[model samples]
Structure formats: structure tokens, C-alpha cells
Target: MLLRLGSLLFALPALILLVLYGVEMSAVSDCTQLGGIYNFDTAECGTEAIPQTSYYLRHSGLVNGMMLLSVLGALAMSIGMLIKGMAQQAKS
Candidate 1:
């Protein structure tokens, strides 16, 4: 019960963030307004374009990738915990 509850808590936040990231990516590509600095004349949030520096490009990708990984990891952990809890209960 405890594991399932904890997994749910973690999974919910991860799923929310993943959905947010997806929305941001889609908005960026669609060139649609995202309010604030993410509006026109910008690539996306936490991103900038530099003439000579590659950091801008790399940083954007890295940030997105990290978020994706976190979401995946959280999902995996949640599933693992739920399975383990079920297995333990079955043995008793």
C-alpha cells in the first residue's frame, strides 16, 4: 500500500512535467505564442541563439533530454515498486 501510494505520487508529477514539456516543444515548433518570453522572437524557454556559441543549441537539447529521462526513470521506478509490492503480497 505504501509503495503504491508513493509510486503514484512520483508518477503523477513526472507525468505532468512530461506533458508540459511536450506542450512546450510543440508550441516552439508550431511558432505559436506561449506567453511571456516564450512568445515571438524566441526559440523557446531557457533557450537562446548565439552566432558563434554552440552552447545555446546544446543546452536546449540537454535540458529537454534530461527532462525526458527523468520522466522515464520515474515511470520505471513507479512500475517496479508496484510490481514488487504485488509480488510480496502474493507470497503471503
Candidate 2:
């Protein structure tokens, strides 16, 4: 149970990142098809260059912190499972 949970936690961030990338790529494609520019840095769609910032970019710190926390939690859970398994093996 712990192992499964740990593995899920470990994969959660990568899954989220992939999903976000897909969404952004879709947006960029759609924007281009509609005769607009997709700004990578600001994540905006406009006819011309504009000074803008994306919500994700603005909250990058928070996002990174959450990912880091989840990874740490996954590591802890995996370690716990290992210890539990070791204890069980020693008892037999």
C-alpha cells in the first residue's frame, strides 16, 4: 500500500507537468491557426508583442515548492515501506 502510494506520489508531478505542457501546446497551435502570436515567456496570445506574464510563471515559486514537497513525501513513504518490509522479514 505504501509502495503504491509512494509510486503514485512520485509520478504525480510528472503527470501534471505533461498535462500542462499539452494544454500550452494546444493553445499555441490554436493561436497560430487563428493568426495570433503565442508568447512562450508570457504565455499570451496576441497579434503583436506585448508585455505580459502568465499566471503559472508568476506563481512558479509556489508550483515548484509543491512539486518538491510531493517528491519528498514520496521518498519518505518509500523509505517507510522499505523499513516495514525489513521488519517483517526479520520477524520470520
TM-score for every candidate vs. truth? 0.39, 0.67
Off by over 4 Å in 2: 39-44, 51-56
Residue 88 of model 1 has an lDDT of 95
Candidate that scores best on lDDT: 2
lDDT score, candidate 2, position 76: 71
Q: What's model 1's TM-score?
A: 0.39
The true-versus-predicted C-alpha distance at residue 35 of model 1, in Å, is 36
With candidate 2 superimposed using the best TM-score fit, by how many Å does residue 55's alpha carbon deviate from the native?
A: 8.6
RMSD of each: 7.6, 3.3
Residue lDDT tens for model 2, 4-89: 67777777776777687689889999999999988877677888866656646866875687588678768978797888989999
Candidate 1: the clashing residue pairs are none
